[model samples]
Target: MAEEVPNSSNTVPIVGPEFARPQPSDLTIIGDTVKDTDGNKVFKVKTPLFGLHNKRILVDSNDSPIVTMKMKVTSKHDRWQVYRGSDLDDKIFTVKRPSTVQLKTRVEVFLKQNQTREVSCDFTIKGRFMKRACRIYVGDSTKIIAQVHEGDDRLVATIYPNVDSAFIVTLIFIFDLINMAGTGI
Candidate 1:
């Protein structure tokens, strides 16, 4: 089953009618013992869309909720946004027709480059791994927390640079944090 979030912060709306695939953050974990037909452990990663959802996020159309190794290799910094949507802050939002399963997926842009993402029906606490991040530095994600901009892209990281005053992102997964001074949430 899918959940509809009127809370703006929790949900994202897609453009097409055939948006039937379950989204990222919605990926499920069958079990530590769950295996694919080949007997390899099947750990599913929730996928996110490209373009923007409402005013907070931008989902890359090329980056689908289900990304396989077979897909194109993104060798560059594909742009992502959090304060604007596809319409560029336009209010003409088209909502999906609603379904039995929630298809909204949250895409995490890893700080490190070249980490493979998978598509599955699993929704794990990868987010919980991020709970304390935004607050520490209040960068791009801060814009999200402040209702400024929003996007589904997340860069996986650890508290590396709370170094002296601010967290210095020191890894390949480093995300560009755009902080608009003074909106002080």
Candidate 2:
């Protein structure tokens, strides 16, 4: 028997319906290009070589900016904020570790509307970064929206239906940055 995917109604699509594949979609991220399982490029990551603050832009196949992720330099938990398109003021969501002293890699996401108090997370990411695997769940629940694991010289993300691929990719990007910082990379 095949495993069942979580119901799609439980989550919101960040980018749009077009990015929410009806079936589980696998994407490979190598360097800047994000390609589907069939090897067709779907998205691109634009990283600036030199900047006082680390920032990255996720662009679609047409080179249109989907989201911009930038790290908060003063955040003890290594927080990152994602904004819609290339406009930094149009913040969409934020991702940060639950605690700065955790032994394992764990992150929590909050939509822009929920950032004021942040009493609860909109989503949670838990896994072992050294193992190169993680699962993104809805809030603190077990309803997984996506899973990511390391691939040969790249990372592979499997996003379930109704979940935005760009959102998942942005979370994964933040996850990578957090772990890289931990290793002094």
Candidate 3:
């Protein structure tokens, strides 16, 4: 069952509280390892060097599969799907650019339950990737759930309390994929 955060009536718990810290948490992604402020490895990303779909798997510190993200090859908007626990059939959400062309980085996220209608985004990310700054907001509202910024040697994400860090990490992974492909990184 999902636990709701107090006063956040519009938000849904993507994962659970175990993924969230009581205070704002700083997660740094360096190479395959995602570390916390105390330099503890929290997650790892397994990316294929050569693959048709550019599939990437996120694993926990204990090497358990958390989620798998893959780009949709035929998508014009740079769409991607995130699946639960390495199962493609268990798609949890979808992420994509709002348009094929944009002045800055803009992404829309739709949870599995919202994909049928997709009348509006369940969450949105907006910012400049070159500047290494972006914010994830609740639906179309300005209630920010997480924010990402460039660190000295890696990208740093500051996830707000009670928000699912795994979900934020997944979004950041997709954001990196979209921007890096554009810059040929």
By TM-score, rank the candidates, best first.
Answer: 2, 3, 1
lDDT of 2 by residue, 1-185 (tens): 44345885644587666678767789998877889988998898888677745788889999999999888888998888899998989999999998988778999999999999999999999988577678898888877889988878888898987788989988887887787673321
Q: Model 3's lDDT to the true fold? A: 0.81
Ranked by lDDT from best down, the candidates are 2, 3, 1
TM-score of each: 0.17, 0.91, 0.88
Off by over 4 Å in 1: 1-27, 31-66, 70-139, 142-185
Q: lDDT (CA) for every model shown?
A: 0.21, 0.84, 0.81
Q: For model 1, how does the per-residue alpha-carbon lDDT over 21-80 read when each residue is reduced to its tens digit?
A: 232221111311112234443232222255322112222223222111111123222222
Q: Which is superior by lDDT, 1 or 3?
A: 3
Tell me, what's the RMSD of every candidate?
18.5, 2.8, 4.5
Candidate 1 scores a C-alpha RMSD against the true structure in Å of 18.5
Task: Give the per-residue Cα lDDT of candidate 1 at 24.
Answer: 21
Candidate 2 lowest-lDDT run of ten: 1-10
Better of 2 and 3 by TM-score: 2
TM-score of predicted model 1?
0.17
Best by lDDT: 2
lDDT for model 2, on a 0 to 1 scale? 0.84
